[model samples]
Target: MPDADNYGNPDYPAQLAEMARVLQLHRGPIAIASHVDADGDAVGSVLGLQRALRALGKPAQAFLRVPNYLAFLPEAGEVSPPRAQLEPGTLLVVLDVDSSDPLRVEGVAIPSGAELVLNLDHHGTNSRRADLSIVEPGKAATCQLVKELVDSLGVPWTADIATPVLLGLVTDTGSFRFMNTNGAVLRCAAELVEWGASLSWINNHLSQQPKSHYALLVSVLSSMEFHFSDLVVSAQINQAMLDSAGAGWEEAEAFVNTIRSAQGTELAVLFKDYGDNVKISLRSRGRVSAQAIAVACGGGGHHAAAGATLNLPYLEARATVLGKIEEQLQIDGLR
Candidate 1:
């Protein structure tokens, strides 16, 4: 665990070390289940750990439940769902996912005597339900923790590992432009780069991937609607809008964050009717806790980014969410 030892000495608790020790015992086979979005952080992390697991001579596989069309990541062609040959006592390592949404764990049917459910993530709202949960909400990305966590397997960090790991760190930090970029993040970035992870290469794949064919950004901006007297900027995308663009739900993801990007905007909500129920995403660039808002609306996310699904129509969900935000603003003022 020398590589693990280097990142956080006394800062990392002994419990995390113990959790890593438990993961090492599953030497035969492992199943790595992760979110399907394959966002930079998610995909990069899956790749990093998958590469590492193979290097350790451990039979490992990466599984994604979602379809590939909506997941337009850089290495989408390379990632396929894992095979179903996982042994009865296989180790299940769940990464970058919060247990608040356990329904995502479908009928993989792990044995009752499964060795370990390694939950590794950096989300503040994590469930801590893993046999070993190493949650450092302060860290930039789960991929950062993943790199450190696998070091306990006695594997050294290399170019193969650093490339994918960098995807998570770079994107999660908003290309190192966000407030979360602290000394630890910078140090990890430097180390990963020195090991042959190219920042420009990663950014080019994500940031500079010509948006020419897609005019969804323009269409979204044209219809961008603001509420709360412009303090809150909101947007909604119906199925018709998706048809107009060459994209779908994932393209609309940038809307909520776009609202938060505006000057003087404090709250942003992006409503998308994704069948049966409407999916609501909340983003707050100010001191407000978007997580609390989402929890109120039956969703969960971090303080800045939160989401939930509402049974009501688009307008009702909007009013309900806005009312709650207003209530919080008043209560905050009363203090």
Candidate 2:
């Protein structure tokens, strides 16, 4: 069972409270950044934290490479594109990004005179590049930790706050179906619902697919292949397929999930061809550690879900990644 206090860290509450106090004391314009190819957890964490800061009467700006499909999200229009520069002495809060490199913060450059760099994330692979970091790998989602922090600050929860937070919880947990969805996660989700999260609306928007997205899915599915006696399923998507389907990277977000859901499959891999590099997303059942496979490929994430980027052509990258996954399976006696 997971720890009940501090959501796995006894010091988490104090650390979060102190961070909140510091942000409140700064009294300067705050800038928030999250990862590109933003998912519900990323989007929810960024928007929820942005809304919370503003509700506290602090001036905050949220930045993301907002996808057109995500515009339906509340406050989606408010997300700014990454600016080449930031104001000096600004407090920049980066959320749900695995790397501490400023470039990973959706192309936003960290101003030289920035007062503080804070990284809030739930990924175990976080690089700890921020001046202050709160990384709880055991939490179901980063948004869950954000909710705890906001609540500790005595910020009253409203629909605006609860909705996005809940969206993060729902998406990250696979609607409470993933392994990380613990008792505390469920309780937190229950509270969000009590606070007026629109369950149906969030589910509908997240699960509904446009015709173009369906076309992209078909393209990916048509390319699916199985390895290791059907225990490992894989798929690929090239840029041409994306363009032909009139879809963006975000539209392919759920492809790995669809592949992973194959009956009797223990692992799923999606290789996205991005001209210069191939982006790999890995998902697995309990039999394999996706993170370990990713780490071997110089990437990181949780045991069940992880990703990596390889600076190799599609065939070469696929061979290398599949080799790593096969090695892991052999070690675990699955091959």
Candidate 3:
């Protein structure tokens, strides 16, 4: 394999080149997949790569259900659900997912019977042993890595491809408001724009939300609780709230970002009741590590943001998660 020449190169450009070289050799169907409850970065990375692969004349398809809010993305209509089985000799490419854990991936199991499995991700915790893995934890978004891969693949940039890749950069950085936004991210955004990415169109679609979303937001906010001199703030959203507001889990997206914006909040936590279990989203500023908190609870994510699902009722899950956050804050000397 040409890629074996520089396997595990510390330099990412070389790593991307190796990935491209390997991908270019495949002459079979390609199926793309990502994490479930797809976010902007996941959706953007999947669509961007899927479109680029097709442009390379490979029979590539994206497998995941697009959330209602993200259905406006370019070529999102082409996305399909996870298949029971893929064509023989298919190259399965999984993106934005940190691990091969079935619970974290979109479908029940990483579809089998592929000629090769390629995993692309930007999470520090990812240790998936795919046939080929391109895991770069420092990347601001997987789309940034995707952009480099697309360039290496010799696929000419188009609005269809650039737009979704830029979407991943924008959303993953909280529209450049989060801690990960840096000069490289800004420069990449500018380059994608030059390639005809529609910034206004992405922003306009991101800005509009339904009335039910706002109603759900109200419930999420009203449930807020402050701890440790207001340095840690927590909130909750349950199925009842969603039903009452005629909303779905998608409507609760970024509610943790909202709570994290509170002044002096070093750590913000949002607990979503999932009947039998509770999903906890964690966001931390400064030296606090959200990833550490999530990992200690059997989940994983980046330093600034992470999540875990506790197999306990809401009350018990809330207490367990809060205890972990408190311990983390104490270690950071913020408690």
Among these predicted structures, which one has the highest lDDT? 3
Our tally of clashes for model 1 stands at 1
* Better-scoring candidate (lDDT), 1 or 3: 3
lDDT (Cα) of model 3:
0.85
Deviating ranges (above 4 Å) for candidate 3 = 1-9
Clashes of each: 1, 0, 0
TM accuracy, model 3: 0.95
Which structure is stronger by TM-score: 1 or 2? 2
Model 3 per-residue lDDT tens digits across residues 1-335: 21222235567777678889888999888888889889999999999998999898988888887888988995535888876687888888889985366677783255466788888998878886788788877678999889989999999999999999999998999899888887777888899999999889999999898899888888888999999889889999999999999999887757998899899888898998989999988988857999989998889899999999899998898888888888988887776
Q: Model 3 misses residue 78 by how many Å?
A: 1.3
lDDT of 2 by residue, 1-335 (tens): 74473556788877798878888888778988888678888888888988889899988888777665556785535788877677877888888884365545673665424678888898878877778888889888999988987887678999889998999999898999999888999889889999888889888887777889888988899999999999999999988999999987777767899899899999999999888888899998888999999999978889999998899998899999999999999987898
The ten-residue window of minimal lDDT in model 3 covers 1-10
**On residues 164-232, what C-alpha lDDT tens digit does candidate 1 reach at each position?**
898789878778876667777888889899988888877766654225225666766776777666777
Q: 1 or 2: which has the higher lDDT?
A: 2
Cα RMSD, model 1: 4.1
Give residue 173's lDDT in candidate 3 (0 to 100). Answer: 92
